[model samples]
Target chain A: MNDFKIIDDVMPDVPPPVVGAVAEARARVFRPHRPHRLRLRFPVWAGGVVAAAATVAVIGTAVAVPLLGDGAGDRTGDGATATATALVDSPGAEEVLDAVADRLARREEPERANWRVETELIERWPFAGDEFLVENRDREVHWAGPDGPAVVEVSRVGTEPLTAADRAAWEQAGSPRLCGSDSDCENDQVPYGRTRYIPADPGDYHLSSVRLSPQELRELPQDPVELKEEILSRWARALKDIENSDTPPGGDVPSDGDAVWWVGQRLLTEAPTTPQTRAAVLRMLSTLPDVRITDGVRDIEGRAGLALTRDTGGPYAERIVVDRATGDPLAVEGMPTVPVPQLKGLPTGSAAFSKLIRRMGWTDEAPALPEGCTPRTKKDCLR
Target chain B: MITAPDEVSSITAPERFGVVFDTHYEEIRRYIGRRLDLDIAEDLAAETFLIAFRRRDRFDPARGSVRPWLYGIATNLVGRHRRAELRRYRALAKTGPPPDDDGHDQRVVDRVAAGVTVGRLSGALARLPRGERDAVLLAAYGGLTYDEIAEALGVAYGTVASRLSRARARLRDWLGVEL
Candidate 1:
């Protein structure tokens, strides 16, 4: 007996689809994207610039680089950096964004030499088996000053199931101890609970693809149009350099709007950008297509803010929620629009990842490294 | 000459994706419908195309053709409903194939023998490991070649061969017939 034919003979034959179902399904392909809040792990530096590779090496941890800048331009088949002509569908969002940019531009604060940012990052860690969705939450502190080598400290808080369904699946799989043995853990997984220090340079900061010193970042053009041009040129040069390299870029080429948004995020979050420059960055982002604003959203920490979302047209949507009053960014998150098969049981709309900004500003206090890590030794600390 | 944005890039143009949808939608729907019911098939089939359109740029032509790639995505979507698939197998094992009312007496007797074989096959399928079962179903229900199954499952060709070998061996033992 032909086993394959036998298997085929047993299966049911479904009738053709209802006449309109196919048309309706095809219509879904071109329907406007509905922006929803999903909390994906913040790629932070990795998604934006090549310099963030330094940050990855410092922590001895490899972060997943999200599909950056693969948005309307990629879909529309316009070449990269086509921001000027991108359609702005949400005028209300533009108004809110403009108001925030104006407020940020007028605000003046004292300049300081040292900066510190404390963040709590929750990432859906990958696993070999599809039994459970494991979320590894960590607390990261980066402190840098003009006079000293920058210090990066990471302390893993915990790792557990991401959702209720994941917990059930874990328990069903005999609850194999996660991150317990050599076989149970991902190779690149940062050791949990203990704070590990990594060496960093104060000058290794990037505005998208362009590396800028603290002084240069502060002195950057404040006009939104000028800033957009500068960023686009820098991204074009970066793309050219990547093309010259032996290895291919490997993923979707980011559009100019994607580049602008990536730089805007970098400026708001980690870069010591002047308030006026930050304002210009926000204004630059408002001009891009598919950038929508949602009022009255809360971050993972329950702080309220207005959310600015860009549907990257990849698996996840990039989101940055900012304080309505001061325009300071409260959180950066990546939310999954499609179900990732590896993350077995994450619910449809639950946050698969998030980074809540606990603290960020100029500081007088020095970075407290882990026991054996010195400020200048340039050594390994995870023992 | 100014190139229209819609036709500039054939690989990622939204307008071009429609061609792919029209070509493969019914075939993909039937594949999913055979594994699960037609109701879930319609929804999942639509979703599969939407996902395919979103990720069209990531499709590497060297790995395989669009047919297996679409099948890969559809198979992945079906894998999401693993419980439903396993339940379907167990239920099929218990009930066997539904009797056709239009058959004659001799045909009915032949169908009864076929029913026993089908039930045994279903039972054997339900017991196979998930990877092996996926390989088997992609071969049987999907009508995909060993190469296509390998690409669809993102596994090596040898792995597909081994999975099919192990799964068919178990089926042969259960049915006591040449596979």
Candidate 2:
């Protein structure tokens, strides 16, 4: 067998205890995929919107936090503490970051010729507790607070220009695979299908030829508000107009694409009470140019969603998650990143599930504490 | 439920959703046997898949399937259960042969490989840093890429590279070769 394919040959059923454990976990934290099911529950949809909105209100605009160096290697120390000591005692104390970053950048890759942007993150904390999709390999992290604009190395996603075929394909899929980072995507179904398009160094990828999804599409009667969401999701017509519109420049905001979103999100949140207001809202939204609402997701509440804008290096959404019943903005959370796909399959973002998803890849349990580690939210440590 | 195994086959294709453990557990068992002791390899291999099933969604579609990630998970479980893995090697080193399933030595190569590996491999593995050891095992044994290793360890891409580089250098030092 090919070395990479060594583990791929075959497998077996897990032991009963393990199977039982996973079953319990699945019930508690995940929802199995219903290949042919698309239940349109309006109230649940509205609840999802509300949940997202709450996330926005809670997470706020700046997602960055001061982590690292807050803990020591003491048995009671958290990631921050251990990282702090690691930084001080690091072999290349002065040049570790530079060396690590350079080594990371220079590593050989499968010469996949496509647009790629790199990110450089500088912090004095080990970001062990979060679910960030770290795009690169170098994590010469220290446990310290940013003395300045903490450096973060990022590779701007080298995206294949929105081709006619890609656009048509996304439309057929019933979800717009618009421009945005993977973080903006839900369930990684990747309506816009990336990573595949990164163009492998050895020409390992090929277009699927087929554009539409095999899954059933939901034709829920979208009321006027839901109509706005549907429009935003129709990338070529709605979102495209926004991306092509004239956007004002600002310190942190992008110059060309986001102004339309700022206005659109405002309108969606205002919950236009009258027909005249709704008309004006739609017209105003229409003016921004093509609005690709590709990063669609069902937030913790369960409403289907769409991304309205992407910042210079972030997600700028003017999402309208209707009460599946009312199809109005039930709840919304304007965000920098979207909920991951697997987590979205759940019925609701229960406290336990939310905590589990955040610690998806790690094994270390949060330390037992006398008065436990006080974290920003339950996602990190106990309240 | 009444018709046939053909009807059952439609519901569970090895390609779509692999077979049950009892029916398809041997290769993984043999894979673990190649490195670890007889005592824990059996159970550790089982725990690996259980954990893999739970975190299956996070598996990258770009990576094609769950096998690699499962191996990564298994590797981690084995790391945590280091003692048992070492015991397998230590027993082989002491006996000058790997223990056979039949309670009798059958394969001649097992005797030579087990005896030769017992001391050297275990000592070298023990000396490796957790990150580097994982990188090496996943690459040399699990056959994962720098990217997959990064995702599995929750470290950055650069960390995977440097860790691999250092790991290779150390393994060479043990093998008495220069990479």
lDDT of all predictions: 0.59, 0.31
Candidate 2: tens digits of C-alpha lDDT, residues A269-303:
42212223333333333233333232234543354
DockQ each candidate and list the results. Answer: 0.08, 0.04
Candidate 2 lDDT, B119-143, residue by residue in tens? 4555666677656766666665555
For the predicted complex of model 2, DockQ is: 0.04
**Candidate 2 lDDT (Cα, 0 to 1):** 0.31
**Candidate 1 ranges with C-alpha deviation above 4 Å:** A1-92, A125-128, A147-149, A179-189, A240-253, A370-378, B1-179
The model with the greatest lDDT is 1
Candidate 1 displacement at residue A196 in angstroms: 1.3
Error of 2 at B11 (Å): 14
Residue pairs with backbone atoms closer than 3 Å in model 1 (clashes): A39-A353, A40-A334, A40-A353, A41-A353, A81-A256
**In model 1 chain A, which range of ten residues has the least summed lDDT?**
A50-59
Clashes of each: 5, 60
Displacement of residue B123 (Cα, Å) in model 1 is 31
